[model samples]
Target: MPQKATAKFIVIEGLEGAGKSSAIALVRDFIEKHTGKAPVCTREPGGTPLAEKIRDLVKVADASDPLCDESECLLLYAARAQLVARVIKPALAEGSWVLGDRHNLSSLAYQGGGRGLMPLVSAVSAATLGDFKPDLTLYLDIEPSLGLTRAANRGELDRIEQQELAFFERTRATYLSLAQQDDSIAVIDASQSMAEVHKDILAVLQTKDW
Candidate 1:
């Protein structure tokens, strides 16, 4: 019999409407097919009970008591710390591949680039996660305007999703810049049709030896 596949951490990242949900489904199915076992799926700022509360705090804002950038960044790390320690680490230890909806990369892009808190984000990430990172990240690239349009079509926009267009522009710029610097990140043009996008994603999975 073939040896069981090694545990791996794979994350899907993108703008609000970059088709991340679909991408995640595909990746989850692919991992199950290859490993003959379902991977443990998780989402950042979530995955755990305490982290879910943090997620609500981050996504829902009170106009009277707005969430400042520094506070937002710290809260994200708090959620991340909980998720990593409680969910991700344990699942990985048990030799189960972990599939994540979002990870540290989202903070680097949204909080670091969108909110201009890279210094604080970097520090928090270092302290919270140390050297932990996804084995592979699939970044779905899409124009901010188009992405927002898609998001709006889906439902009411969240607090972060309600940000000005310039915010998303900054976030996208950061994502592209970071992807260029990291080979573990693969950029997929999410502007393509679903068929095309899935094809590209499959290509990445098949080609990358990870």
Candidate 2:
């Protein structure tokens, strides 16, 4: 038989309280059912050792010594570069599926829409990895306020998580716009109950349709 194609890179994206953690588990099981191989799960800014440290560095920022938005954007790209080169690429080469908690789209939504830095985000992504994208992206859409409420209940908010509700609205808008243009993205109504959301996600996964 001819050699099989590499397993796809699947990414899960959403606001803090959009049930991404639980959704990823569902995605993992879905991919395994189809491919008979367990997927590798990785979180942005902290897949590897150095990337984890970067995650910590970017997570907390003092109000007295806040990080510049531009610098914050660059650090995110740096960590992404490390994770992509170190983890994602290798896994795909070995033909194992990869499940990403967040990928390049997060930067576009958060740093671009929220921080008003789309140009910088675009330039960084193009320079670091031109035209590289996940095979499929599942965007869980939810109201910003509801999502924040879920996140707040989880634990203390991170630096970016502490942003005002307006910031998240802009971010969600950007994510929706991107999904509208990309066929590979499946947008799930995350505001629904867990069972409904999971069912929608499974439908997309089984059909391979957005």
Candidate 1 lDDT over 54-137, as tens digits, reads 999999979999999899899999999999999999999898989999999999999999999999999899998899999999
Number of clashing pairs, model 1?
A: 0
Give the clashing pairs for model 1: none
Cα distance off (Å), candidate 2, residue 105: 0.4
- Pick the TM-score winner: 1
21, model 1: CA deviation in Å?
A: 0.7
The local distance difference test score of each candidate is 0.92, 0.90
lDDT of 2 at 202: 91
lDDT of 2 by residue, 1-210 (tens): 222376788999999899999999999888777777788899997899988888887898867878889988999999999999999999988988899999999999999988999999999999997988999999999999999999999999998899999999999999999899999888999999999999999988878631
Q: Listing every candidate in turn, what is its Cα RMSD in Å to the true structure after a full C-alpha superposition?
A: 1.2, 2.2
Candidate 2 global lDDT: 0.90
